[model samples]
Target: MKIRRLASQIVLPILMVASTPALLHAAPLEPTRGGEGGRIIRVTTLAKDGPGSLKAAVEAKGKRIIVFEVGGVIDLQRTILNIDEPFLTIAGQTAPSPGITIVRGGIDLKGHDVKISHIRVMTGVDGQAKLSGWEADAFSTVAAHNVIVEHCSFFWAIDENMSTSGPRFNGKTVKEWRAATSHDVLFRENLAAEGLADASHPKGEHSKGTLIHDNATGITLYRNVYAHNMERSPLVKGGAQVLMVNNMIFDPGHRAVHYNLMNLEWAGHDYVTGEITAVGNVMRAGNSTAPGLPFLTLGGDGDLAWYSKDNINVDRWGNPAPMFGRYGVTKAKLIEKDSPMASLGGLDVMPAKDLETSLLASVGARPWDRAPDDIRVLFFVAEGRGEIIDDEKVVGGYPHPSPTAAPFVDKDWNLKTMEPKSGVYPGQKGGAQEKLSARDEAMRENAK
Candidate 1:
């Protein structure tokens, strides 16, 4: 099958002219007065006490609007002190330096209406063993409602060997622990990439009530991408109620999308009743050393397990086909153009009445719908060449660039979901004759 390739590049310039004054002068967002109205505060320093200064300014202003105006690097070694009020807006400069990296003691939020934009919250680490003070986690939230975390990045590093071997690989060491718990949170147009080492620690964790809308959620993950992410499986113990759409999740280690029952308890306790909708996502699995199954469903074992389908699809070769342990999918369908998933009985879930109505009323197509099945999807490898190859072929063809390369696919084909199946529910079985009849009809139609 032909694989679809997309070239990943840093498009924005690293440096740009400072325009804080101009932005401030242009137009204010309807400034409010006193506690009832919101005020704007700018933080433009790179001191270890930068967060302290910012917090003081916010308190002094007595307004909720707080902007991180510092254009240069601000080392966040516990910079953000506390976030107690609502209607807070923290915006950074457009230019990029080291950006804002919070190590330990992230921002704790209370109330609602918090907005953060144009910043990179990275965890700086020295080596796999010696984590930088920032690797502890740059920013965290707690009981914050209607929060918006947009146009930002979250990164960390991990040990290469330790991630693959030891208890970490078995998904035991990585536990679910978020610095914060946000409701109605929006994480849009951001990038969550892996640092130098395996940065997949703190795995098997969940971020509740998060809307991962239109972002490069997981990009450039070399070694342990979601190896031990407890949050990976929404039905699992650490899993949370998350709306993940229009994102790219690439894992060179284990399955890119892992659903485990171990993390589902948290969902029940938190009263999170939303199902994980893996729609319009691009997931690329690891190469040689990497397991073929790019997606795995652990726990939820037997007949009571959960499954994914409907508008939810996967590439045939790059990742292993979806695996079901005990649970099964409900009203789910999988599709792939010229791939195995395509042949698997399923139907398209898009172009529904609701989707068309929403698209017509919106400003434009939803970010997640950019590469809709109707659009032409393209893939470009680092080598600047395009070809279809199996996992083994792709891995063998490209010399492992780094030990990390052991998990990423270098040369591979590109495939798209075409002619999505129509109206098929999960957990239903069909006889071989029925399957053959359907295939024959599709073939005849295509021939015509």
Candidate 2:
């Protein structure tokens, strides 16, 4: 498929004089306060490849708000900036055009308390063998903590579009997500698309979207839209406390979600699966799509599954469609929680109606730029040919191949309840008379 990443280039002296003052100004130009409202560092150059340009601005001195004075494509030709600084922000919203687009390279975010907003990353748009590692994904962190990625776009990474993992990749160990162990990480109001087919990690034609690898913790995925890729619209692999809510997955080339418990991909040790709570999630087949792609994949022996509630198949306009016809989803029992979800653990589950409305309003970069409406990404929309995506060469194989011996149990059992709760129950009672109203309702309705 033809992929289009939004970006621009730099001019000479004229550009410098025109944009330098905007860069030096301290006014708040980003969507929200990042770097905890720290120093302002503006990116003045749009050079296709350079050292003291965009790359240097991000890795500048200390904690700061990094904004772009000019917006356009920066073809890095396979260079990756390892963002090891603490308390930093990459604000693409400050760009004048369609926002900053990076082609042929991606950054590895290793710092703490960082925010990446309003940018487009296309690591595979270039036909080169690719400069970075296989998993250099559009955005990745080995062990970054308190990181927030929102209102951004990623497509056609040689690896997954977005991911997090432990420090171990092979025999080599990285400090990204290793010693610190990621926690309180949030991904919201963003769009992830087309994980391109590549040979580096052969299992995935372009396998993953938002992939959370082993040993991460306290993740919150809220109101995002993931579309047209091989799989892993947020795959939960040996994660520790993940709360996924109000996200939509559209036209997946394979399964939409997988909770992988048994994996041998890492070099140091075996990967262990973690807990997940999925609420108000929508998985829908897109228009003019291919056939035979399933909606969910529970890896070999079906071991990992956690709390799930209120998932359905529908388009952006709320039109219903089969998530996948092969699986009889409505009656299947597919999810499991570490403990009963009744007590309502630490997850802050919002009312479905409110969450859906809010998400539809804010799923993309602009308040009105919802994914179904403004997302015109072409990689996933067009590129599905010549790649062999059978059982073996799937799961974006890297350190190890994902186990596909057992077929996924089509639907979630949610066996904790006699059945999954279907109606809207007020999440938190507000009025003083709510208890009295409950009693009165019980008395009125229980008599027969």
lDDT, residue 57, candidate 2: 74
Residue 409 local lDDT, model 2: 21
Count clashes in each candidate, considering only residues at least 3 apart in sequence or on different chains: 46, 21
Which has the greatest TM-score? 2
Q: Which ten residues in a row have the lowest lDDT in candidate 2?
A: 14-23
- By TM-score, how accurate is candidate 2? 0.64
lDDT of candidate 2 over 79-126, digit per residue (tens): 786888777777665455434577667878877777776676766634
Give candidate 1's TM-score: 0.47
Taking every candidate in turn, the Cα RMSD to the unseen true structure, in Å, is 18.6, 18.9
For 1-103, candidate 1 gives per-residue lDDT tens digits of: 2111111111211111111111111011111112223544545554546353455644443445444433333444433456666656664432122234333
